[model samples]
Target: MIKYFVMGLRGFFLLAAKIWSFVCYCFKRQARTVIQHQTVRYEVIQLSPLSKHRLSMLKRKTLVLDLDETLIHSHHDGVLKPTVKPGTPPDFVLKVNIDRHPVRFFVHKRPHVDYFLEIVSQWYDLVVFTASMEIYGAAVADKLDNNKGILRRRYYRQHCHLAEGSYTKDLCDICSDLSSIFILDNSPVAYRNYQDNAIPIRSWFSDPTDTALLCLLPMLDALRFCNDVRSVLSRNLHLHRT
Candidate 1:
């Protein structure tokens, strides 16, 4: 009887420890998120009043999207899956020339990615901004595009600004009009300087049930009609902090 009681006591302590550990982990995550939020300066650009003619003539809004974790996840070293689907092989087998040696990379597209790009293209000028080598980024973009003609421009790692051990994407470098340009990326650091014009997304990996891309369609569609994209983004910026 005493041994059984002791075992129960031990089990309770083990469960308690686990619960405490989980709480600490959650607190740490929240703390990190808070820090990221505080880092954002919320510097909304003061735009010159647009003339009626210029507003009417403004083309489509510009959407700069990140690669890798945002649209797809890739690894240079991995056991090639027999097929992503029953009869389909991996999406694309790309060879990148690195240091005079060829390195192969396997890419997997995010769920609903094709539909996302197709629909978004109609509403915005799509640009791929990735902190990865051009060789790799171009191949992945090609595979995803497949002549669909959605992507208007591609910016690679060379275009990114490296600071404090992380790459920061400067929207100003791409275009001077902050009101019409926005970025979608998984990394908060990438858009730290442009928080007012950033839409932070969760990193996508191998989740077949992931609906992030599809879920964004409604919001993206609405943003296309906004006079200034940053005005719409700034209101929900808190929800995206790391």
Candidate 2:
């Protein structure tokens, strides 16, 4: 009995060490990213009105975004609704007919997504590509865009390539110019074929404090000026570098 107990204790300590190491790594990485974002804040503030116009006039690159967990979380009766402890709340609720049944969905927007969109739209021509079916994805996009025209065009599930039970997005469908286009997605498999042009973000679900979108502004702002987005994205030193 004592031998078994000692063995179990050793295993427990090993597991605890692994967990602690992972936590420390995540904390340190976040600290570094926060410092970088602070530096970018000053640079963003210094830009003049004229500078913005000039930047907008430059050859705008295409920024393809993902929906669902990337920008918003959709919760239906069957889906998991966030406990919604403090600040986060569903932006809107929608009733849609899916396969002859009307379903109500509660959508919670990722924090800072609005400001992030406003800033990135000026720099890059925005496009939304989602793995979800058109019936649902199109409605969500419309609700999020609110007819602002910031989100230029959208591609739905029909456009995705189904491979081995996973839906993979084809970036070429959105833009022929590989150098000028890149995709912002939370799922690695979506961009598995085009890894070089992919910027991975953490999948968000009801976290009111989530700042993945805000933290991305600096790098995205700088990307517009680069000749080829792949050249910069290949470095892959991002907050959620997949």
Q: Worst ten-residue run, lDDT, model 2?
A: 36-45
Per-model TM values vs. the true structure: 0.72, 0.74
Candidate 1 residue pairs in backbone clash: none
Candidate 2, residue 82: CA error in Å?
Answer: 5.5
Residues 1-242, model 2: lDDT tens digits:
99999999999999999999999999998987676445223145657797777676667789999998899887785655454543445799888898999998888888777778777886778999999988888888888888899875999999999999999999888888888999999998889888789898989987656788888887887787677888988777453343
Off by over 4 Å in 1: 1-59, 78-89
Q: Give the per-residue lDDT digits (tens) of candidate 1, residues 133-216.
A: 898898898888889878758999999999999988999988899999999999989998898998889998666667788778
Candidate 1 local lDDT, residue 87: 41
